[model samples]
Target: MKRFVQARAAAFRGAIGAALLPLVLGGCATTGINKGQINVISTADEVKMGQEMSAEVAKQYTIYNNAAVTAYVQGVGNKIVQHCDRQDIEYHFAVINKNEVNAFAIPGGYIYVYTELMRDADDEAELAAVIAHEVGHVAARHSTERMTAMYGYQFVASLVLGQNPNACAKLVTDMAATGGFLKYSRKDEHEADELGAKYLYAAGYDPRGMVDLLNKLKGLETTEPTKFDTWFMTHPATSERLARVETEIAGFAKLTSPVRNAAAYAKIKAQLPK
Candidate 1:
């Protein structure tokens, strides 16, 4: 099984490299985001790619079925999205039924949080912190940027165009099995932390929620390392990230009142599987 998976991953990588060779050699046209980063995939194509990839994700993992729990997550995610940098695409949020403590965003605006992460959060603000960070990745176009840098723009555009279904499926499959093969860099992780704090503050959630969530993860890293393996695979060091989040929160102007919404979140938590 391991050899078969490795073979599929290698084949997918080779296929993408071959398909994108021309665009890489000739240099492709790029689009700009708020962060001034260039992306080879346009917004429309990004959304299409996300829709396609999300379908594959749905096949790989079971989405949490409780409407109330899912709706609560969407509500928090929407609140953060309102204050995000990109508004071109509609954001979709869902909870995965998996027990692993992780959250991830795909090419477009689709963000997913795991049930274990939700159950672990102390309040709504902490949950919002994770969602905002994922939203930050979306706003900054980190996924497509990383994809463009790794696979080349033409290869990703081909996925958007449905030019190679087998390669696309293999790519998503490898990502799922490996806890996200399309991992972001340390720079990308820091930028997302900064942006998440900004959104958390602007959305009327206490900016400290970001700090608290990072600290919680840091503790989990020390105590229950296995639960955080997938999260740490995608996200870099929690201690460093927590320090940066604290610095970001320190810069925020004091608001009259900030929201944590612990009570509401507790109700939502009760609805999760025990």
Candidate 2:
């Protein structure tokens, strides 16, 4: 009887795999950022997946409730998004009340920055650099790409279709505990840094801000390793990355004056809870 039950379970698994094969092959799509590369998730479905996962993220983290600060972040993010490559979807930025130095972007353009990261920024340019990097990830469709690579097209399609209702929640839980979909490949990270520098320059912010932000995070990695844990996990900062970003920034035309906006950022930073 036990042998028969095991055989049935095996057959059930095989049947499920067979059923999903068609959907996986049919879902092949190309990314806007890299036309040569193929993605199994469509943009519309990626947006749906992002919407579901964002709701789960909200349930897991406390969103900072200050209207003025929220608007400020949205404004900065908008400046970056206007110059980003992917404008098909509207971008949303919010602040999480947690005191951790981390920021991440979900599929479809939802981005979250922790309060500690905001507090640590010395100027608006620094903050904008961070937001632009996350925007870079969104524009490149890195999160969904990573998800498709890790979980397979069928599992990702199931999450978007809501066929596996609990899967989104499980993904969010895993993201909070481990990096999950938030953890991107090194190549993805390099592309984001390069794109972010370009966006920062086009948006009228100093591209050097990206360099400064990396340097700041590098310092924190040594002095306050605990605060940098989450960011370090998802976005590893290395000397090579910093040097590459510097080279990218150096290639840009020299601006007579670039935005730093230290005073404005100071006023907004003052509003955060002590």
For each candidate, give its TM-score against the true structure: 0.89, 0.89
lDDT of 1 by residue, 1-274 (tens): 3445445545556666666566556654444245344455778898999999988888887888899998999999999999988888999998888778888888888898988889889999999999999998888888887776666556676798899887678767767765653667789889888888999999999988888888887888888888876676677788888877887788789989999999999999999886
Write model 2 residue lDDT over 138-255, tens digit each, in one string: 8888987776655556678789889999999977876776532456778998988888889999999988888898888888889988886656656655688899998888778998
Error of 1 at 132 (Å): 0.3
Q: 246, model 2: CA deviation in Å?
A: 0.6
Candidate 2 residue spans exceeding 4 A from truth: 1-27, 179-181
The TM-score that candidate 1 achieves is 0.89
146, model 1: CA deviation in Å? 1.2
Clashing pairs for predicted structure model 2, backbone only: none
Model 1: CA > 4 A from native: 1-35
